[model samples]
Target: MFERYLAALEYPSQGGINIDDPKEFRNIVLWLEDQKIRHYTIEDRANLRKTGSATDWDPAYAKYKIDLGFPANLKSKTEELTWLFLYAIKLEYSDNADRYRSITAAQKIEQEKKSSAAPEIKSTNPFDKLDFTSPDFEEGSRKLAEKLGIAYHPDHLVSLRAASYVISTALNKEVLKEPIITGKPFPIDEGIGMGFENHQDLEKAARILRLLQIQNLRKLQTAINETIVAVQNITADPRTDTSLGKVGMK
Candidate 1:
């Protein structure tokens, strides 16, 4: 079924369709949605819990996990790369939503505060509002440091440097096509434990992480947009440069 879907999108033989093509991409998205619905119908029945049962009928959430793996499989394919492409757009939307909520919350807080201190800057840019206290940021930073053979410290300058490197790399590859390096393992330290040093540190860390997430998301959107433009140029005329140099040079 997945192969048939890819064939409909003209994968491989036609150098595959661009993820930015709204009409074509929407078809692919709808197909995915339909598949997900079908999968949920089957999985839900298999895992349905009894009214008074202490244990789930299907252990380990196998049904949902199996269904989720289909998307992951699509993401792993090189020839059928639309999954990651579409996934990036979804992430960009989520990040935008988060940024909006954060801004709204900040505005409310500012309005409630009666202190004489000057008003704080409220940036819509996601990177500017990263919160390092977030588990994602801390975990990502620690894992990255460990991978790079650097020691991980929660509040240390080195940890921040490591996080910046990790965040930059992820953004460059997953978000921006101008990746500094390719085929590198994501910097994540699974061994690092999670706990807050203090309330101040936690707040500061969360802010930093939020900023990084937003920046990364923005980069992804930009890269996707560039891909769309390149595809449009090619569709207009086949003589256009389709080489990696042209596509990558931007």
Candidate 2:
């Protein structure tokens, strides 16, 4: 029934339809709300070994809230509907539905779980080996010296290297703290201390990295969408391909 509604919305196409039309969007939202309420009521009653009825399901409705552990109860039908609507919109707007779905689903689950995990911090000594010629090595040393208002030395350089490693590790750990679809940490390469030859080169590198990251995210979304489609037995229509191209889905 959910998939049928999604199909009615003509999802899986680029910019498939404008949900900005308040009346129509609201109608769709209401329909989704009804569906969710009915589904939840049925599931809850079955779990409790009770004869499920509208009145009997009232107690099952609860506000969604994040706790230290366990998924939150669904707060309201509106929230569930909103999520479904946004998901469909995202899928239609972005070519990479799979990645979006995976990330979104993981986030939703994490929100419910109220994850208490903290990032792991790693520290290292930088001065054991010296490679001052490399921009990354030199820049790290220079930044540390400037920040500390101290003269540069081999020992200082080593300390700076260690600091850089620590900072990079902390950042990566934070990213990993987020729940992932695979329930495994993402593989991050060794931290490269920032040391570009010039500002232009730095800007270019940043831009390239951003683009690559976006593409990677898109790929992930696409994979997730494919998985969902397969599980739901949704087949890709040839018309969807043409429609996607028309809306610049690439």
lDDT per residue, candidate 2, 131-168, as tens digits?
76787867777787676555555665676766666567
Note each model's CA RMSD in angstroms: 32.5, 28.0
Query: Model 1, range 126-155, lDDT digits (tens) per residue?
Result: 977877678887777777777766777856
> Per the 3 Å backbone cut-off, how many clashing residue pairs does candidate 1 have?
24
Candidate 1: Cα lDDT at 124: 90
Model 2 RMSD in Å is 28.0
lDDT of 2 at 230: 86
